[model samples]
Target: MNNSFGLTHIVQFFLFVALQVLLMDNLVLYSTGFCFIYVAFLLYLPLTINRVWLLILGFIVGFTVDIFYDTMGIHAAASVLLAFLRPHVLNLLTPRDGYDSSDAVNIHVMGTRWFLTYAFTLILFHHTAVFFLETINSQTFLYTLVKVLISTLFTGIVVIIMQLLFFSPKRERIDYR
Candidate 1:
C-alpha cells in the first residue's frame, strides 16, 4: 500500500474500533440486535489488498474488540472467517461487467442491491460464528439464532447508512494507449 492509503486505513481502523467499543457496544437493542459496525473497516478495504493481509487485518480488528468486550477469541474467530470468505464472496457476486481490481468495494461502486446482498451475507456469517462460539456450551440454539439474525440485520443497516452518508463514488478515467 502507498503511504496515503496506509495512513487512511490506519485512521479508519482506529475510528471504527473506537466507535464500536465506545458507542455501538453499549447500544444493544432489546438485548438482541447488537451492531458490530467495526466490520465495515474490513468490508470496505481496497480490492487490491491480498488475502493474507485481509486475514491479518481481520484478526487485528477482532482481537482489539475481544480485548474490550472480554469475549475471549470469538470475535477473532468470526472476523478471521469473514476475511477468509471475503474474496470468495466477491467472486460469487461479481457483476457481468466484472470489477476493476482497484475498485473500492462500496455501495457507490456496486449499487444498492449488490451492496445489500454482500453486506448482509457477510454480516450474517460473522455474527453467526460469533454467537455460536460465544454460546457453544449453552443449550440456547434458538435464542442464539435470534440474536444472530437480528444483529446481522441491524449491523447491515448501519453499514448501509454509513456507506450512503459518507462514501462517494470514485470516477476513474481510462487511458487507452
Candidate 2:
C-alpha cells in the first residue's frame, strides 16, 4: 500500500465484484447460507499492506457489491470491520517463523490448516455482521446465528476451493547437468 494499488489488484477487484454481484449473489442455499465470495479479494491482499489502505479497499469492495445488491452500505460496514480486524487475526495466527511481507494469504502459500482457520475466523465475523446488521432482532437471534454460521462455512469453503482450482503452487525446478 506504500505504492499505488497495482493493476493486478484493480483487475481482481473488478472480477471479484462482478463474480459476487452476478453469480454468488443468487447462490443462496436453503435461504440460510449466502456466499459472499468477494471477501477473498480483500483477504488475499499482501501481508504488509497498509491498514488504512486495507480499510479503503475493503469498503470499496463491499460498496461495489452494495451498488449491485441495492443494499445501503451494509456490506461496506461489514467489510470495514473485516479489514479492521484482519491484522489482529493474522498476528494471532502468525507462524513461528513469521510471514514474508510480500506473501498473499492463500492456501497456496499458507497451507490448508492455516488458510482454513484464518478464512473461517474472518468469515464468521464478517457474516455475523452482515446478517445481524441486516436484521437486528431478538426474535430471530437464533435463526440469524444459524445463518451466520452456515454462510461463514459456505463462504470459507468456496474461497479455499477457488484458490486451489485457480492458483498453482510454486514448484521447484531441478536442473541437471
Q: Model 2, poorest ten-residue lDDT window? A: 168-177
Task: Give the TM-score comparing model 1 with the true structure, all chains together.
Answer: 0.93
Return the lDDT, model 2, position 83: 96
Question: What TM-scores do the predictions have?
Answer: 0.93, 0.91
lDDT of 2 by residue, 55-158 (tens): 99999998988899888999999999999999999999999998875566768778889888888999988999999899989899999999999999899889
Error of model 1, residue 154, in angstroms: 0.5
Query: Over all chains combined, what TM-score does candidate 2 have?
Result: 0.91
- What is the lDDT, from 0 to 100, of the residue 91 in candidate 2? 98
